[model samples]
Target: MLRFAPSPTGDMHIGNLRAAIFNYIIAKQKGEKFLIRIEDTDFSRNIEGKDTEILSILNLFGLLWDELVYQSHNFERHRNFADYLIKHDKAFYCYCTKEFLEKKKQEALDLRIPFRYDDAWAEIQKKDNPKPVVRLRGSFEPISFYDEIKGRLEFYPNELDSFVILREDGIPTYNFACACDDMIYDISFIVRGEDHVSNTPKQILIQKSLDYQKQLGYAHLPIILGESGKKMSKRDSASSVSWLLGQGFLPQAIINYLIGMGNHTPVEIFTLKDALEWFDIANIAKSPVKFDLKRLRYVNREHLKRLNESEFSLLLQTQDITIGALGKLYLEEASTLNEIREKLGLIFSPKDIDVTYEGESFKEECLKLFEVLWGMSMQGESFIEYESFKNEAMKRSALKGKKFFKPLRILLTGESHGVDLNELYPYLRFYFKDILRIKGEK
Candidate 1:
C-alpha cells in the first residue's frame, strides 16, 4: 500500500499536491491501495477545515485515497510501541531539561566538540530523578539505508542525538509515530519529499528494532522550489493550488506542469491518465524542481487549447458564463474553442489582466481602433467583417503602424498585448458588448 500523509497546517500548495499526485499515480499503476493519513500530531499548528480543503483539491485533480487515517487517533498504539522499545532496551528515558541541554550544547561548542546530546547525560539522568521522555538508543557505528532516488546514504550514530521518541507530553514525535503507522498499515513503499531524507535513518532504526525492515521501501521525491531558489510559501501568489484554480488554471494542467518539473521528458503536457501510465519512481529527478509561473502558464495554455468544445464550455460555465453567449460572439466565425480561448482574454474582468503600455500616440491609436470596431457594431454588421474595415481606416488615418494596433487593443481587451484583434473582436461582440459600448462612448 501507498500513503500520502499531509499535515493539516495551511492551504494545499503545489508541492504538496505534486507529492500526493505522485503517490496516487504509483498506487494506481501498481494496483495497490492508496491511503490518506492526516498527520495532525501537532495540535498547535492544525487549522480548521485544512483536511477538507486538501481532500477537495486532491479530488479536483482526480487523486483519491482508499482510506483516511488520523495520527491523533493512533496515540495509544504509538505509546504502546514506545513502551515496548524501552522494555527491549532499544530506547531509554531521559529527564534532561531544556536549560540543561542548551548549556551543554554551548559547552560543547566552546570545546569545539560535536554539539549533540551525549549518552553520558542519559546515565546522569538515570541516576537522578528522571521525568521519562523516551529516547531511541543509537549504535556506536554508522547507520545507513538505500534511498530509492538518492542511492545509498550513511549517517554516523555519534553525529545524531538520542533524539526524543515520546515527548515529555507523552505524544510520539514525528519519526516514532510515522514509523509505527507505516508498520501497522503495511505500507510497502514510502514516498515523500526529500526534506525528510535525514529522518529516514532514524525511522529505519525504529523499524529495524521492531523487525519490520523488509516490509518497507523508501523513496524521497525532490523538493519544488520557487524561481528565487527558496521553498515556495503561501505568500507567493502562485504557490497554492487554490490560487491557480482561481486564476482559471485547469487541474490537469497543474498536474502536467508538476510532472514535467525535475523529470527529464519531452512531454510538456499530460492528462491524469497519461501521468498514471508514465509515472516511474526510478525516473524521478533528484534535483530540485524550479517553479516558474511563465512555464506553468504556457503549459496551461497548451492544455486549455486541447480541451473539446464541450469541456471548454463546462469550464467557462463553472465561472458563471455561458457557452451559448460565448459562441454567439467569438465562435460565430471561428471553428474551435481553442480559437475562442485564444481571444477570450479580451472579455476578462479588468483586474484579471495586466496591461502595460505608456505613450500618447499608442493610447490614441488604441482609442481610434476601438472607435472603428464600435462603428462596425453600430452599423449592424457582424464584427467578423470589421478587420478589413479596420485596415482601411488605419491606412486612411496614416496611423496604420504598430501604434495603431495598441489603442485598439487596449479598448477591445483592456490590455496592450494578447489575443490578436481579428479573433478578439468576435468574442467582444458576444461577452463584452456593453463594456465595448461604454469604451466607445468615452
Candidate 2:
C-alpha cells in the first residue's frame, strides 16, 4: 500500500501536494491500495479544519484514496505497543526531571558537543516509579536502508540516542506513531520529501525494537525551489493551492505543470488522464525543480486554448459566443480567466479622456472618434461592420495612420495601447451599443 501522511498544522505546502501527486499516481500504476493518513497526533498545533481543507484540495485535483485513517484514532494501539516494548526490555521509563535534562543539555552546550541521554537505565530490571516519559533503548550499531531515489543510505550509531516514544501525557511522538501506523496499515512503500530522510533510521529502529521486520521502500524526492532559487515558503503567494485557484488557473494545468516539471513527458501539454498513461519514476529529475510562474502562465494559456466553443463559453460562465470569442481574442493579451475577464471589463467601462496622448491634436481626434461612435450607437445601429464604422467616423475627422488608428484604439478599448483594433472589433462590434453609451453625447 501507499500512503500520503499530512499534518494539519497550516495551509498545505506545494511540496506536500507534490508528494501526494507522486504517491497517488504510483499507487494507481502499481494496482496498490492508496491511503491518506491525517497525522494530527500533535493536537497542540493542528488547526481546526485544516484536514478537511487538505482533503478538499486533493479532491479538486482528482486524487481519490482507497482508505482514510486518522492517526489519533489509533491511540489505544499505540499505548499498547509502548507497553509491549517495556515488557520486552526494549524501552524504559525515565524519572529524569525537566531541570535535570536541561542541565545535561547545558553541559553539552558548554563543552561544544552534542547532547545524548544516558541509556544505562534502559537495561535496569528494577522499575522506577513516577517516571515522566517512555524512551527507546536505541541500538549502538550502524543503521542503513535502500532508498528508491537516493540509493543506499547509511547513518552512524551516534546519530541517534534514546528518544521519547510515549510522552508524559501518554501520546505517541511523531516518529513513534508514524512507524506504528505504517506497520498497522500494511504500508510497504513510502514516498515523501527529502526533508524526512533524517527520520528514516529512527523510525526503523522503533520497528526493529518491536521485532517487526518488513522491507520498506522509500523515495525521498528533491523539494521544489522558488524562481529565486530558494526553498518554497508559505509567504510566497504562489505556494498556496487556494491562491492559484483564486487566480483562475485551471486545475488540469496545475497538475500538468507539476508533473511535467523536471521530468520527461510525451507531449508539451497534457491532461491528468494523459499523465496516467506515461508517468515513469525514472524520468523525474533528481535535482530540485524551480517553480517558474511565467512557465505556469504559458501552460495555462495552452490548456485554455484547447477548449471547444461550448466549453469555452461554459468556462466563462456565459452562453454567449461573443464573450467566448472575446476570450479567444484576449488570450493573446492574457492567460488566466480572471485576466481575460479584466480585459473584457476595460472595453465596457467609461473611458477617461482627460489623459493626453501625443499632443492636443491626437486627443482631439480621439474625442472626435468617441463622439461619432456614440452618435452611431445612439441612432440605434445595434451592430455595424468594422469597415462601415471606420469609414463613417473617418469622413467626419479626416485623420490617418497613427493620428487616426491610435486614437481609434483608445476610443474602442479604453487603453492607449492594446490588442489590434481589427482583431478586437468583431466580437466587440456586437457590444458597441453597450461600449459607446455616453449619456450627454454632443
Candidate 3:
C-alpha cells in the first residue's frame, strides 16, 4: 500500500502534483493499493475549499485512490496513542508554560548551544498535578533508516528535542498523527518530499516506543525548483496547476511535463496510460527538477498535434465559438490552446486594421487582388488554397514580395505577423469579403 498525504492549506502547486503523480504511478505500476490521506489536523491554516479542490485536481489528473482517509476522523485514536506512550513511560507530560520555555530557549541561545528538554521534567511531573502538554521520550542514541532515493541515513536522537505529541490545545501534532495513522492504515510504503526527512527519525522513535517493529519503505523525493533556481512557490504563478489549467493547458500535457521532471525519459510526447508501461523508481533522478515553461509549452503543443479533428474541435467548442471556427486554421502554429484562443480573439476582436501603402497603386492593386481571388473562388478555381491564390495574385497584379502579401496580411489580421494567411485563407475569404461589402470597400 502507498499513500499521498497533502494538507488542505492551499491550492496544490506544481511540485505537490508531481509528488502525487510519483506515488500514484508507482502504486498502479506495482499493482498495490493507493490511498489518499488528508493531513488536516492543522485546522487553523486549512482553507475552506482546499480539501474539495485537492480531490478535484486528483480526479482531473486521473489519480484515483483505493481508499480515502481524513486524519481528523481518528482524533480519539491519536489521543489514545499519546496516553499509551505516557503509560508505558515512553512519553511524559510537562507543565512548562510558553513563557517558561521561551526563557529557557533564550538562555540556551545565549550559551550558543542547542536546546533539548531536560528529562528532569519527567521527575517533577511525578510530584505535581498540573495541566500539561504530552512530549515523546526519544532515545539518547542515534536512529538510522534506509531511504529508497537518498540511500542510508542516520540521525542522533539528541539532535531533536522531546517534541510534543499532544499540544496544550488537545490537538495532536503532525508527526504524531502521521505516525499513528501510517501504522493503523497498514501503509506499506511512504513517498514524500525531501523536506520531511528530518521528521522521519522522530516518527520512527514513536513507532519503536509502541513496539511496532515492522519497517516500511521510504522514498524522499527531491525538491522542485523554479526558473529562478529557488524552491517553487505559489507566488510563481505558472507553478500553479489551477493557473496552468485556466491558461488552456490540457491535463495530459501537464502530467507529461511533471512525469518527465524526474523520470529522465527521452520520449517527449506521451499519454498517462503510455507512461504506465515504463514508470519505475530507478528512473527517478535524485537531483532537484527545474520547472521550465518553455519545455512545457513544447510538450503541450506536441499533445495538441496528436488530438484528432473531432477531439480538437470539441475542445475548442468548449472554450468559444471563435476558437471552434478558427482553431484548425492556426492549430499547427499554436503551442498551447491559450495561444490558439488569443489568435482567434485577435482576428475577431481587432481594434482596427490600418492600411499601409508601399507604392502609389498599392491600394488599387490590393483591392483588385482581393476581387480577383473572390472571383476565382466563385468560379470554382483552386484559389481557395492560399498557394494558388498567392501565385495567381502575383501574376495578375504584377506585384512582388511584401508590396503584395504584406498589405493583404495587414488588411485581414491588423497585425504584421500571425497564422500564415495560406492556412487561414478559406476562413478569411468569406469573413473578409463580408466586411468589405459592409464597409463599401468591395
Best by TM-score: 2
How do the candidates rank by lDDT, highest first?
A: 2, 3, 1
Model number with the top lDDT: 2
The alpha-carbon deviation from the true structure for residue 26 of candidate 1, after best TM-score superposition, in angstroms, is 1.3
**CA lDDT for candidate 2:** 0.84
Ranking by TM-score: 2, 3, 1
Q: Over the stretch 1-442, how does candidate 3's per-residue lDDT look in tens digits?
A: 7899989998888877887887888888878999999999998899998989999999999999899999999999999988899998888887877766788889999999988787676445444536688899868899899988889999986776688899878899999999999899887878788999999998988888888888988888888899999998889998889999988889999999988987767587888888888877667789998989989988988888777656776877764343355676676677888788677666544323234444333455556655665565567665567777778867876767877776566556645567777767766655654323212332
lDDT of 1 by residue, 1-442 (tens): 9999999998887877888887888889889999999999999999999989888888888887899999999999999998898899888888777777899989989999888877667756555555668898875678787778888888987756678889888999999999999888888887888889889888878888876757467788888788798987778988988888877677888888888887865466779898776777778888877898878777776776676656666766644345534533443434333445555554553422123476343545555555665565566755345567567657645675567776556666656665456754544555444546333233
Lowest summed lDDT across 10 adjacent residues in model 2 is found at: 121-130
Residue 75's lDDT within candidate 3 is 95
- Candidate 1 residue spans exceeding 4 A from truth: 123-130, 213-215, 231-235, 318-358, 361-412, 415-418, 430-435, 439-442
> Higher-TM-score candidate among 1 and 2?
2
Q: How many backbone clashes does candidate 1 have?
A: 2
Candidate 3 lDDT score at position 72: 95
- Writing each residue's lDDT as its tens digit, candidate 2 over 71-169 gives 999999999999999999888887676766788899999999999888764334234436568998877898999887778999887888888999888
Please state every model's RMSD to the true fold in angstroms. 5.1, 2.9, 3.9
